[model samples]
Target: MKVSPDGQPTADVIARVKDIPLYREAVARGHFPVLEKAEIARGFPDNWMTPALAAALDAGEAEFVLSTGTNHARMQLIRPPYFLLKSYYRLWSTHPDIKETWEAGCRRVSLTTVLATEHVARVNAKKRGEEPRPDPRPADRRLDARTFYLNTRLDPALWERADVERMLAEMAEARQAHPQGWYHLDCSGYHLAHLLQKINKWGLWDAFSPPASIIHAYEFTPVNVRRYLQQHFACPIIDLFGSTELGYLFYSDRRGRYHPYLEDMSVELAPVTEGSGLFHLIVTSVRNPHMPLVRYRSGDCARTLDGTPDPAKIKQFSGREKELLESPSGPVAQGDLDALVGSVSPHVFVHQLRVLSPAEAVLAYTTFDGRPLAPRQVAALGHGVRELTGRRCVLDHRDHIAIGKSGKYAWLARDGK
Candidate 1:
């Protein structure tokens, strides 16, 4: 458990790294460097893909697959997709209260939370009359929840008539795929919250059956939006924290507590500073035999146990490291802001805290149309920020939170890195 300056790999990580052809020489040198995404991309198929691995992917195996991209732009990884899906399923199957609805079956439906940026890029390229490369064989053929909603993007008028009709149609299709009332809702929380809010607004609650479980990934879950889902659905709402490169690593429980579920992987928290308790999650996952990420910097942050990086005691996975804000007290993470807002009222759907300077900060946020944060709630938020970061902050109420062109939201957007 002792950390080296370079974060030494354990016997397991070393053994796995040695198995990869690319890392064989580095392993022989008796000192392995961290596996970086940029380094991995220098020569993609040649860097990590062996003839056997490439052939397997070419042959179309469900276990070995490709991804579009995640919140982080444009980086693709080839790994087992369903491997991540089943991890959540198994976690749900083992949980006590959380498993009540989903225990009967693993039936599920997926609603994509992100726009297919890659597809849009290709469409734009075609408009300019440039020949875009064809999608790799078999990789493009695998179908899952994302297949249904890749082309659409969310916006202010996301649930409008035409949109509502389309959503209802998609829901009907998903329902037909799973007739049982109790099922898992694999979706983006933002999309689901908006859909549920619209359903309530249009009085369409009875039109569709409630899902037994709701699993939201792809983006940071806002407290207010989560509250919206909790209020509407009787099922347990869980957050699966992971990326395409690394499968499901941790998930949130009903109590908002994060529990570790590593699959042939080990995680270490390397402190961002001396004793910040916030550390970079350096993961060594050999689960992907082709690309065994050893001491890979995930660019994600978390508060660990007892000011130490105890894998089992990960308090929360804040957003990306570059997205974190510098404050007078210390660095403020997305989870830190989430706590400040969530405590006051979980209904505060979208919040963006901009650090104007060391002395001032502005929190722009919105809630459901009818419910507003009370004066006390506003005061509590300001008080919490002041206590947490020693900043003179105030809540700037917003009518609506705008989605980016990518149909994604930024919980933390700063002036500079």
Candidate 2:
């Protein structure tokens, strides 16, 4: 529970670190420094594999897994199987806005990337190791007793009418599976927005049931997209902030107010650059018993309400540290551009900032209604972009902005890098 002046853990963190073999040399060297992914990858399992940890692995109490590599490279991790799910369930059951539905024992329908579904399938197949089971059904991709996967493809934008209908039918089946006839919906915000668009276009609303609560935990949700989801579902729509390694670290309520969900963890914010509002997320957590992390840089960037490193005042999970762009003005993050676009118009769906040169960039976007922005709104957004990046901004309207191969969207793009 004790934390340092900067929100990093104090005695509690040291106690956890003192017992981990991986931290012995770092601890002996003097001060416990920030731990990077490179340092973690350097030694692999041997670094943290104590006798107890190895025994746990053998006993299937813990498992070795790789991160999704969405934000950065795939990170090797060790923790109990379903560690992330347990964390997510805890948050869902305790979050004020969603507790009642959770208490009602609602089923879970997950609509995220097909990669996630495939990863689970691969893991399960490898674990089974040739044990025969019933043939897998194309429509039935259940992750657990309560959670069902609905996305069978990578690109939501490319989902044909048949695909949309199948997902809706699966959702209806998921709802009926629970005795209470209720289910909590979990999804990537972008995926949900795309699904909504498809549903509206195809008039498939009747086939889909309104979830008791909705949590978008997979990736960053644009302000406009969040607004778009709000306009359709009357249920509580929340955004969860975390990673595959950390689980649900924080979550936003129905009102879009953030609350920390750090049970056995602490956080610190170190500025990306001196005098810059942007800060790198540094966390000290003992949540994962086999792989406790101290002063770990999560590769995420954020901004506090007053531009200070008060963890409670964390205003935005702006973007990844690696993706932050150096602008003539200073530094520009995905969130900064999002704020400008959202302010200009809520119709903007997805946007990508392409830096052409040091002094020029193009903002390509798609609208919810598939129409270009008004001339005045376009001019306003262009002006804001120019001021933020200190570049001549060009607004380009597009019918679609492609998702990455990983089934996520990159907000910033620069040639060759």
Candidate 3:
């Protein structure tokens, strides 16, 4: 069966696969070898390289482009055509509870870092005692209008209290200009939350208008920060889950439950061990025509709350396969520890958790750039870990918890020689 250039499978193709003996046989074996065969035939491009994506690029239908290196290294992805993104817009605008607080007709104002690339260049220029050159206007400015390239390597010292206050003032000005306006923020969750913490710590919250909705799309949001934003704004916080290779696949409802959006994608959970409940995510997606992926190992672990494939019942998108800690007792996901720490103290930003002994662990975290954690807060964090994991952990405040060169935080680290 062949897929169309636009990623739509033809009627003949659908009919052929509807009763194909190979598909039936594969399903019976709890696998999809035919899809794997097709992927292998196509050289197994990432799942995001679908036929629709190629068609969109070929026809110049994409609007915004985003780059992500979170998993398989840096690569660009085009946002779906306006019509497709509008579907997402509609979902938010028409949501019953959300629509009441957020005005539907107001145009969105995007608040992001200024001169994102120059931020890095300025840092480099300072070392050489030279001024950074102004960015040249591209010949095709329209093509670059919606493109935002953030230099993720900026020094934390630059984003001080004054810089945070200036951003809040801008947000306030935007709100005053359009009283009913909605804000559409785009940035890494960690960066945005860090900025907000500075604002709060500096007493700037009352000066700015609360955003109608907050969308954190670029990276995984630490659970505590999500709760804080929701509580502070009293508005819905939306999270988009997908990769550059795959278009947006899931979105959280107002209640923060993820619902799959891919009608052509099916998910299966194969237990890592008998009765473990933890399982590997096996996906068979027919969405990408140019490069289809069948029975693909997404390298993520999850467990169904009710032990079934009902999308609504999927309780947790646990952790990356490689990040799982295999101890003598069993496998423990990093996400579990993240939740435990966050629950203990919302102010704590744990960058690494090291197990020092079977019953003891050490937490290394940065308290807003050497701002010491109160003794009671540190104790509360330790107590929370003991309550959650039954492991007594010593909380240590550090000058800084190093982000990986890749700009990701590793939550857990095993003791090494």
Using TM-score as the measure, the top candidate is 2
Q: What lDDT is obtained when candidate 1 is compared to the true structure?
A: 0.68
What is the TM-score of candidate 3? Answer: 0.67
Misplaced by over 4 Å in model 2 are 6-9, 127-140
Model 1 residue 343 CA deviation in Å: 1.8
Please identify which of the two predictions, 2 or 3, would achieve the higher lDDT against the true structure: 2
Which scores better on lDDT, 1 or 3? Answer: 1
Candidate 1 ranges beyond 4 A from true positions: 1-7, 19-22, 57-70, 80-107, 114-151, 176-179, 370-372, 415-417
Runs of candidate 3 with Cα error greater than 4 angstroms are 1-31, 34-67, 74-158, 169-179, 287-289, 307-309, 355-361, 366-393, 414-417
Ranked by TM-score from best down, the candidates are 2, 1, 3
Clashing residue pairs for model 2: none
lDDT of each: 0.68, 0.85, 0.55
Q: Candidate 3: minimum summed lDDT over ten consecutive residues — where?
A: 136-145
Error of 1 at 387 (Å): 3.8
Per-residue error (Å), model 2, residue 61: 1.2
TM-scores, one per candidate: 0.81, 0.95, 0.67
Which candidate wins on lDDT? 2
RMSD in Å for candidate 3, one decimal? 7.7
